[model samples]
Target: MDLNIFREYDIRGRVGPQLNEATVATISRALGTFFAANGAKRIAVGYDARESSPIFAEIMHRELNASGCDVVSIGMVPTPVLYHTVYTADVDGGVMITGSHNPADHNGFKICLGKGTLFGEQIREIRDIALAAEFAQGSGTIEHRNVLNAYCLDVVSNVKMGERKLKVVVDAGNGMGGVTAVPVYQVLGVDLIELFTKPDSTFPNHHPDPTVEENLEHLIQAVTEFEADLGIAFDGDGDRIGVVDEKGRIIWGDELMVLFARAVLRERPGATIIGEVKCSQRLYDDIEKHGGRKIMWKAGHSLIKAKMKETEAALAGEMSGHIFFADRYFGFDDATYAGARVLEILSKSSEPFSSLLADLPETHSTPELRVDCPDETKFKVVERVSDAFARTHEVITIDGARIVFEHGWGLVRASNTQPMLVLRFEADTADHLDEIRDEVEAKVAALIAATAA
Candidate 1:
């Protein structure tokens, strides 16, 4: 097994080369051995609609069983459904076979151990055990259960959308979102417009990643044509949500948190909210203004979830569309649950969805920018850039380096999932945004050159 696939957040890689059935089977055995040693006797396993997911699941089932753990197979569902099963079934561990926003040819696993996500060094340990051919001897049972109905019912039961129903659009992008979202939204009594809701691993209409504006074009258009109140799109596994207002304007993840924060603070004053460093500073300020405590942490859903657990934050989100609400539900990032909460907020208000945030301080911000730097050198480049900036500017190094300027801020962070660096900038004005971005870009380029030299 290639240890590189054992990322900071989850295990993922290109399907043919690194994530083939045999490779996943070995990794599954490793996970099983680790789980059995940790006293996990019962485990829940699920897979996405990706073509490779089922094959991965079968192998995982046999391996986990071989390692002395019962496998609860919740087959062919969204990633969150797998998470739901783990909690509902009271399992000691869970693994969801999903590639998330990556293209169809790439796939991986999101794992949970004892009600919390398994990540970081924990994932690396599995890789080490896999390479060493570690094994535990026993034959455990396997059971199949369909938890989709229960999961959907649970979401509707928990979320109070109020008496007023919303007219909404849901674009699953031909991914697994439709498998669960369709049922949940239908029961919510919303005037729903379903687009590309079919489960097609090819992602025929658009990519499943909602963070990429291009994937949301069809969603935006659907919102306008349907004249719906708003629209929501989900990633491949349905954990990240992308929203668009009635006016066809994209409501980013951080902005969505701000909206959720306002409502949460009104209900529970002094609530703690967590946002990633990549989020606009405005989000933190808005939380403070609303009598809420704000914390900016590293990017990545697992990292944010861990921080939320430590901080007791009611709400937490990343710029990439992973939103977690611990106040009324489990702490994992579940876009399906978030969509209902969003509609609930809109239902209780008379104003347009866009108007809720009209009072926010406006600023020019750039979407996340990706720069291709090999995985081995990405962190080094960030370190050099951080050192140079720290000498003359205030830099936040929680994840990578975020240079704080009087007019705005610029962030350069290593992408946990890919061989690249993620860059983002925001400022009080367009010119200032450009200035800071250029400064950071030039410094990054110089460091990359120096590293090569």
Candidate 2:
């Protein structure tokens, strides 16, 4: 087992050296042992459209069964669907095998224990069990089941939509979202246009990540050509979502949260909503202005979900497009479900798609910026830079360090998934945004240099 594959959020790595049948099976057995020790009798397993995902899912089922846990297979589905199973199904835990917007040659497993995902130290401990080949001994059982129809119906049934007949385009990026999204949206009374509905492991059109502007370019073009009300896109596993307005403006996650909060607050007044450190300050400000409480927590969906439970928040969102709604539906991040919610909001309002966000205070913010720093050195570099900034600025060290300036805020944190440092800046103006970004980037460069020396 390669220790590096055990990330802070989910286990992910290139398929070549680190991930193979033996390693996957070993890790699965470790998970089974972990679950069995935790009093979990049955677990569910699902996979994405990635070429290796189904194979890995089968291996996990075998290993978990060997460890005495009855495994229910959901076949190929979205990551959120797997998460949905944890709540709707009778299983005690769940796992989803997906690359999650990574390159085609990469894949990994998102494991859950008792309806909650394991992260940080919990993920690292899996390596210890797998390396020692320590697994529980018992004969288990495996069975295949389909939860796609039930998932779609549950989402569609919960969300309330109007008869505005929303004309929208959905770009699945050739991922697994279309499997469930098509049925859910079809029943939602909308003139929905679907793109890349087929689940293709090769991703012949473009990568599945909707966060990248390049990936949303096609969605943008199609929305304009079709004169659609708006456009929505989903990542590989269909958990994260990205949006394009009627004018083809890329509506990021933070901005999307602004709309979601408004709708949620209207019904449940003064409800609490959570946004990560990298989210725009405008989001917090607007949420408060709307008589809703706002909490800024760490990134990562697992961390955000845990915080939601702690704060009893109605909603939570990350800058990278992970949007969680505990308002009308489940607390987990589901892009397809969120997309349907978006349409429901638009169907009620007569305002243009761009106008849905006109009430929020304006601020210029850069998309999350990532700098390549080795995993071993990334956190150290962030620490050095964070300490340097703390000496002068009012820095928030929730996850890494976020420097709060008079005009803006800058964040530099080590990415839990990759070998890099993630940065984001938001300011009152373009020049101020540039200034904040440069100041923090210079410190990052200096820290990297000091590490080399």
Candidate 3:
């Protein structure tokens, strides 16, 4: 088996090439063994709408059964629903077969143990067990359950949009969000315009990831054409959300976090809120100014979830669209529920979404830019950049290295899931932002040359 599918956060790889039946079976056996050792007797399994997901789930079920664990199959659903099963069902652990925002050819798993994420070293242990080729023998049953209706009802019950009747457009990017979100929106009494609502693994419109500007084109166009009050989009597994205002302007995750944080602070003053290091400084300033405690943590969904639990944070969000609200909803990232919460907050206020953002201070910033680097060399480049910055100036190493200068801050961090260095810069002025960007780019180039030498 190509064991690299055993990633830091979850097992993910190309369906046929890296994640064949044998490979997935081995992973299931390994997970079963790990859970059994930890006193787990029952596990939950859920799959997305990917073409390979059903086959993968069947193989996983067989392997888990062989390892002496009863599998509660939650059928095909969004990742959030699978996560919800872990809490609502009497399962020791749960696995969701989803590639998330990756391409359709890709499919893998995200796991949870009880209320916490089974990531980091836990993921590595599964690899070691699988590579050892150890298997446990037993007969366990696989039972199917449908939690979509219950999940939908729970979401509507918690989020009351009040009397503000607003028109909203939702672009599911042809993922599982269309299956669950449509029902929930229908029950919540919002005027809905659905785009790419059909569940298609082959994402005909665009890639499911809404964070990239290119992927959000269809959603923006539909928003403007329909003159909707707001536009929302979801990633493949429907755990992350991207949003646009009524005017078809991309609000971005940091700005969205500010809105969510503001709403949460009004209900619970001095509440702790967490944000990834990649978030804008304005987000932190705005939260603190609004009588909330802001804590900057590392990026990645698993890391952010763990931080949220540690801080008992009421709300947490990443620069990407992974927003987790622990206030009225579950702490896990649920884009459907988050989109509802956003609407609930906006619908209560008379001001337009654009005006709410316009009140904030403006600054020049670069969206996340990716620099090509091989997986083997990416971490080395980040280390070199960190070392160089440490030698000359102050740097924040909370995630990678955020080099702070007089004009602005420049960040260079290696993406955990890809072979690239993620960079972003922010400054009070465009010229200052450019200067910081240049300095960071120069450092990166120097690091690359040194590696080649």
Candidate 4:
């Protein structure tokens, strides 16, 4: 089996080549062995809307059961619902079969051990175990449970909307988000304008990823045409969110965190709020200004979640829209719950959604840019870039290279899931934003070329 599928945060790769029946069975057996050794007896399993997901899920169920794990089949649900089951159901561990914003031809697994997802060395350990192939043996059983309704109800219960009903636009991009989130919005009495609510593995409307601005065109148009309160879009498995304001202006993840952090701070003074290094500096500033402790940590949902628990943070979020709220809910990243929280904030206020951040300092930034780089060499390229900047400039090397400039900041990090280099830049002015981004991109390109040579 191709071991590269064992990523830093989860197991993921293209369907036919890197993942198939044999590979899936081997991964399942490996996971079962790992979980059993870790004292996990009952395992919750769920798959996303991808065509290959059900097949893989079945393989996992059979393999896990054969390996002495009683499998709780949660059926086809979003990634977050699988996570919800891990906490709500009587299970010792959970596995979500999802590619999570990748193209339709790809699929992967998000493994949850105990209450948290594994990352870094934990993922490497699983890969090592898979290579060793010392199988654990036993006969286990499989039980099916439909938890979508219960999950929706739980989300609805957490949101206390005001008397002002909301007219909202949602673009699910034909992924798993609409399957679960639509019901919650209807129950909340939202005047919902939905696009692509059906679960199609083909992703007929567009790719399910909302982080890329191009993927949100339909959402932006619908929100503007409807003049709705706001627009929300979810990634393939519904773990991440992308939002637009009433005027159809896209509100990036850092901006969303600003709203969430302020509300959380009001309820729990001095609460800790964690933002990844990719987040805008304004988010950290806002957290501190609102009497909440601010923490800037590494990216990736599993890494951020671990940090949140370590610091006992009330809230944590990524620039990629993985928002976690531990203040009044589970700390795991759930776009459905995050959407409800956004509506709750809007319901209580008479101001337009865009106005919520009107008082903050203005800045210009770019959406995350993914540049192709081989997984084997991406880290070295980033290290070289970091070293070059560190010689004469201030740089934060916690995750990759976050070079601090006088006017703004630029980041270059190797993606944990895909073989790519992720880049982002922000500055107080548009001109500075261009300057910073150009400078950083040029340096990155040179390093990548040098590495290739």
lDDT of each residue in 41-156, candidate 1, tens digit only: 89999888888888999999999999999999988988888888877776898999999889889899988888789878898888788888968879999999878889888888
Q: Which candidate do you rate higher for lDDT, 3 or 4?
A: 4
What is the TM-score of each predicted model, taking all chains together?
A: 0.97, 0.98, 0.98, 0.96
lDDT of each residue in 335-432, candidate 4, tens digit only: 99999999999999999999999998998988788899998899999999999999889999888999999999999999887789999999999999
For each candidate in the order shown, give its overall lDDT on alpha carbons: 0.90, 0.90, 0.89, 0.93
- Candidate 4 residue 108 Cα shift, in angstroms, is 1.1
| Superposed model 1: Cα runs more than 4 Å off | none
* Residue pairs with backbone atoms closer than 3 Å in model 3 (clashes): none
After superposition, candidate 2 runs with Cα above 4 Å error? none
* Number of the top-ranking candidate, with lDDT as the measure: 4
Worst 10 residues of 3 by lDDT: 130-139
**How big is the positional error of residue 207 in model 4, measured in Å on the Cα after superposition?**
0.9
lDDT of 2 by residue, 51-124 (tens): 88888988998888899999999998999999999988999999889998998999998989987988988887
